[model samples]
Target: MIQPLDSVIVHTLTRVITPVIQLFALYVLIHGHDSPGGGFQAGTLFAASVILPIIAFGIQGSLSVLERRAIILGGIGILLFAGIGLLPLILGGEFLNYGKLPIPGMEASARRHWGILGIEIGVTITVAATAVSIYYSLRERGEGEEK
Candidate 1:
């Protein structure tokens, strides 16, 4: 069992800062196409956002929100990436050849742009879920050893 903190200041600060962290993470993910921030950076930020509650409220509290979804999230992310790549192949183009994508209103450049965005979204999901899974697994192992 985890003990609740007695510090009001810490709790309040954590609550306030966590949302800001998440917002910044989203900004990084969205603006990555035009800037330095991208899937890896944004994903790390997202994982940090999830982890902040663990620092404040312990693993139990964090797990209550993250649950057992980390692996599922990671798998879904990989599938999305692979599926997008394979879509071009299924459309009679080389794998990941976004130029041949069948969007009706988009030029080849726009198709490639959308394809890159899809890949970035996949990478973001995979990285964040993998980071959270590692954290949760390590914490669980540490708790077992402590007992």
Candidate 2:
């Protein structure tokens, strides 16, 4: 159990800055396919946003907000990535050949763009959830316990 800090400055700053960080993370995730930032960077930003509160308010409190949701998100991410990858194979194309994705009215190039975006989204969610899960596991260990 993380002991909640009593400092007003820390709590106030965390509350104020967390949302901004999350918004920036979303921006990074969205523009990643075209720009420099991508799933891994955005996911790290998002994980850090969640962790800011955990650090200021304590793990037990943050757990209620993120624990189950994180697990579910991780599962969703994996399923999405696998489903997208397999869709191409099922359609008689190689795995991850997004040109064969069944998006009605989309040109092959467009479908490829959308498919890459989907993959990036899946990666972002998986990375963020994994980071949060790792943080929780590490923080929840018993005092004096070694792993």
Candidate 3:
């Protein structure tokens, strides 16, 4: 629920820019470990990704597009990270120790790198989506909440 004042500036820009931002965030998330970016950076990018649409289309519409499944996304992310960590424990190694991932024919170093990457990806998605939701909620002033 955008106030008339918010409609003038934020809404217009977000209406056109959110999709592009989301795409960029995915690119960053996928390329994170190899490039200069990682989970934290990519997460912020994703947060910004949703902001435009939220500002433009209003909170409800934005939720229809992305926000509605925020908790589900976060759950999956947690599972991914936890699964990776559990693999090590099952293999008799320390937590987050990917030497236990059981990837056949992969070198130890390579396995470790891959594990870190998977964990980072999960972190990025959960954190970014959460941030976006919070930002939208805070921004949606004058929407007239019910008692």
Candidate 4:
């Protein structure tokens, strides 16, 4: 995405605003277990935090931080889910059976939370990328149709 306007003022504001969004994302991720917010919300917020720069400073600036990392992040999230799901099998329960996570301090609820966090991150990445991809595609298609 490209900024509609280029100005030093917008750049300065963007510098100030991006960090706040990032901190909120972290809050959502950590406090998610007992609250209404969680990884999905946080991940998209994270993506949006990055995307805002794209909208304000253009793609070149957005790439400096967010880059093409969403794809890799999605993969890592999947791996995390798989590892958590396998924990049950390692401890003699069936796949995805959370109670067997094999730690005394952690309960199945924690497992559920951990496993869900991974899934949510994966969901967020795919969703955020897909949203941007669709917008770009449709915009391009619309332009082509005008010819």
Top TM-score model: 1
Clashes of each: 0, 0, 1, 0
Report, for every candidate in turn, its global Cα lDDT versus the true structure: 0.84, 0.85, 0.75, 0.66
For model 2, residues 89-145, the per-residue Cα lDDT tens digits are 999999999999999999999999899889988988999998998887677673226
Model 1, span 1-147: residue lDDT tens: 344575889889999999999999899988988988988998889989887777677776676446457978988889988888999999999998988877889899999988888888888999999998888777666666766
Best-to-worst ranking by lDDT: 2, 1, 3, 4
lDDT of 4 by residue, 1-147 (tens): 223458888888888989998888778877786687876787777767766776676555645323444455556666666777887898899987766776678777876666666556655565555444444444345545746
Q: Where is model 1 more than 4 Å wrong at Cα? A: 1-5, 65-67
Better of 2 and 4 by lDDT: 2
The 10 consecutive residues of candidate 4 with the worst lDDT sum are 62-71
Shift in Å, residue 41, candidate 2: 1.1
For every candidate, C-alpha RMSD to the true structure in Å: 2.0, 2.7, 3.1, 4.1
Off by over 4 Å in 3: 4-16, 65-69, 139-142
lDDT of 1 at 25: 89
lDDT (C-alpha) at residue 94 in model 1: 98
TM-score of each: 0.90, 0.88, 0.77, 0.70
